[model samples]
Target: MKLKSFAIFGTFLCTSRVTLAKSAVLDQTSLIYEFPNNTWVENIAARNNGELLLSIVGTPQLFTIDPSAPSPRQPVLIHEFTDSLDVFGIAEYQTDRFAVLTGNFSFETGDLGLGSWAVWSVDLNGVKISIVNEEPTLSSTPKVAKIADIPPAQILDGLSLLSQKQQTLLIGDLSAGVIYRLDIESGDVATVLNETFTAAVPIPHFAPSGVGGLHVRNGELFFSNVGQQKLFKVPIDEDGTPSGPVTVVASGLSTLDGYDDFTFDCAGNIFVTTGGGNSIEMICRW
Candidate 1:
């Protein structure tokens, strides 16, 4: 019984702040897993063999967790999209494949209209289960191929994986705050960075902010900005252009309000996910 707590039904606003390079001491713990409270867990990937992929917002599911399973974490349901699609920002397109980013949005009007978006290539064995009624039974799925088409003023949230040998991809346009560079073998989309930032946060209604979590280390290109709660880093020139200006790797940290999506761990540690503060925050370096 070392699994902690895992429930999933909304109401979990968390906020944290701690930055250090050589002096560490931030151990906020809460490790739970077992989704489905009307499920809404968009984006989270980690699988070199450890397994853990989750992106469930509205439906067209995709959930999996197998932390070497046995202790109490079972969260299976692996892949299932095409009810008009609704998966979002998933990466890892090589072994067992996975590079999704769909959006037709309308789980009854969570509204993401103007031009349904796409960019798929999933096949982790394709639609496994969890499509409980309302149609979608699968017959020969998973080999989806749509590639690119995001222009309704952009709302294709995050998706990184810049080169499966030049297939290229790095889209992140949370409502036109721009950061595109998709070339998925020739769909050609480019707009490197438009500098995401869109304020107004009193929360009640009025959403569609800008750029939220997108990574690409070593060549630098980290971003975040739920209405500028801040966290940026630029410099990437080898042809995928984006050289100079845009630095502020983490700023004014204090609860990190609504910045969604971010993951990195292998000891590098930096886990950020803040949907109006439903938290998943961790930043360790030391």
Candidate 2:
């Protein structure tokens, strides 16, 4: 395991025995629902019914997975989005604020702007539902619009909401080497970290690697190290800056778009949806 420092409440402190180890051999890699080959699942948000609110490339699908039942669960297709979206980050915010980022792609110039991007929102629960796992049918066709255009630079993975610190939306731009914070109400966007996220904590050049997936718990920022396959806990200060020394929470992840979005179940088991692995992989601390 890599040696790293531990921080408390966003302040750098002493060291700990945190290992950059595999979170756990994925115990559950069950299939929720699989669409066509063009049906590449980019981001997934778990619902209360063991179902998933999923986003496919250039489209959207809502499907369910019964861990108790089987693999290749023949994802029940729900909604097919034909908006002007290219598809990327996605998240469910309470009963009202469901959000996602329409990937930054230039149909004309093909130049992915370093700042070209947009945000869309709709009522997550308010959307019509047909199956516990089937994609939610739109009650009135969910409203889609461009909020803040992201400067595209081969932007890899991202998240719509990461924390509750006054509604700050965190997004990670992989190749552009950027982390942005967006204002939920005003639709303003700003970069959060100006440093390399995937680059090892002590590495000098290349500033590590691109950011893939990030999740916020309480106030600590928990993110998967796609460049490193390690899980890290970046504690925040009173100002919410990722100031404290970072702790290697889990490690040994395959550095091949190894992860996207992850969260802890009520039982405290850390679960992550692996990218290439096509499985809902996870680790637990009991």
Candidate 3:
């Protein structure tokens, strides 16, 4: 089978096939879709039904694109955020349900303006839409709950569903340089990793913290560091504790810059989004 690469620029979705030899060659190129120019796609989550959910940083909106649809495809705006909140990371909670992390911040400067943060349960069924998960009680209009009462020093950039059955989540703190595990059922949060990186490339006067993207696959947790420009994997125990030292998966690849979030295809191919460059890249072994 041939390895295919899908990259998204400002509005154009470019598809290419890579022929790996001593050097990799782009065999073909095609345009898949063209999104709105103002849409700054921060992260993407693939659904089981082959649809894609995109988080936009430029606006407080979430879009869904069905590539399997007929030609001349268009992305549908499925969700919108109010109260100046913008989605940074998203993960599938169930079939049509999703866990969305939102905060009040500037995507350009990476500055926390109001310093508000919360996790929400978004249902894509019927008329019922989004609900704040941190509410103390379940009601028709439950009050929004903050993740924690601590100071707004860390930027929660990435989120992944730890276990659907256990209702747990894994979140990465970009500024604080740590990974936190949150229990959706009990509202308990804990730190999983807290190692500081000495060789971090400062984000050019912006937030200069390590740890960018996060994903869990095959009982292991994988993360990327924008400062270190590296990707590492660690064994995660059944109880959600990281058990072993970090193993480097890939590093020093020129295609990656400010690696933000990544997802795996059905064939196990990895697709990474670079925040600094605003591009998507596909990785596969020859």
Candidate 4:
């Protein structure tokens, strides 16, 4: 099944295909898994063997779940960051190596603790952990490595692999409204893009967030402005620098909430998750 047709709302995971019609319709919908109430799952990443890595904000834990498992299977605990208050973005940099973002965040106030963010590397190299049936037996737990501490980032929401050979990752800073390039090998961070398209709307008594979701595809950097409810893409070089102007892919996604995380399909369809809206919206590019 194509992962682009899947979306997770709250703690429940569901899949639906978008067909060509006057109005978009979701078909083949099924719930893969569901967590307890208020278990805010922030981000998700897929493993090579089809297991899913879930990042939770409130619990500040990382979990692995098997989508192909029988209904109502419990997700296995991968690793929990004890010191962090929240886990936000996750991206598979290499084959089984995932880069995860963790920090202190306030769900009630929408505030991120300054100077309290870090990047981590979760390497699942040669490790076997059972997902279904009985209790999970971890012969060897996955290696967890701290890559770097990001002190200046306010709201780092999205992570994407910029270059595998360069060992770099692209991070979306929601508060800063810029895309940052992080050198995993050197622990260096640089702003690659800063424009009005990424700026958040100023609202009183609320922590504004702009850039939310990010992905690199077809030599272009695709990102979402959550505050603006727009999706855009721009051609970029190998070093994560913009090579062309930003072009809007979709807009006005407002349905009582803003956009959060998203993914692209092989057929060029974009699937977006609405944070509080409890719905998944799809944009088909024919």
Per-residue alpha-carbon lDDT of model 1 for 1-286, expressed as tens digits?
0012235322212433444422233355345565544556777776666566777655667766655444445576555666545677888757757777777665455576557777777766534323235332333455656777766434576888776777687877666667778887677787877743422233224355677668777787787776666666687874456777777665434543656577666656576765655555566543
TM-score of 2: 0.67
Query: Each model's C-alpha lDDT?
Result: 0.62, 0.53, 0.63, 0.79
**Candidate 2 weakest lDDT stretch, 10 residues:** 1-10
Candidate 4 matches the true fold with a TM-score of: 0.88
List the candidates' TM-scores in order: 0.31, 0.67, 0.75, 0.88
* Candidate of highest lDDT: 4
TM-score of 1: 0.31
What tens digits encode model 2's per-residue C-alpha lDDT throughout 23-62?
A: 4332323334434443455666655654455655444333
Give me the runs in candidate 4 sitting further than 4 Å from their true place.
Answer: 1-25, 131-133, 203-206, 255-257
Off by over 4 Å in 2: 1-32, 47-51, 58-85, 104-116, 131-136, 152-156, 160-165, 199-209, 253-257, 274-281
Model 3 regions more than 4 Å off: 1-30, 108-110, 126-153, 197-201, 276-286
Q: Model 3 RMSD to the real structure?
A: 8.0
Report the Cα lDDT for residue 204, model 3: 60
Q: Give the winner by lDDT: 2 or 4.
A: 4
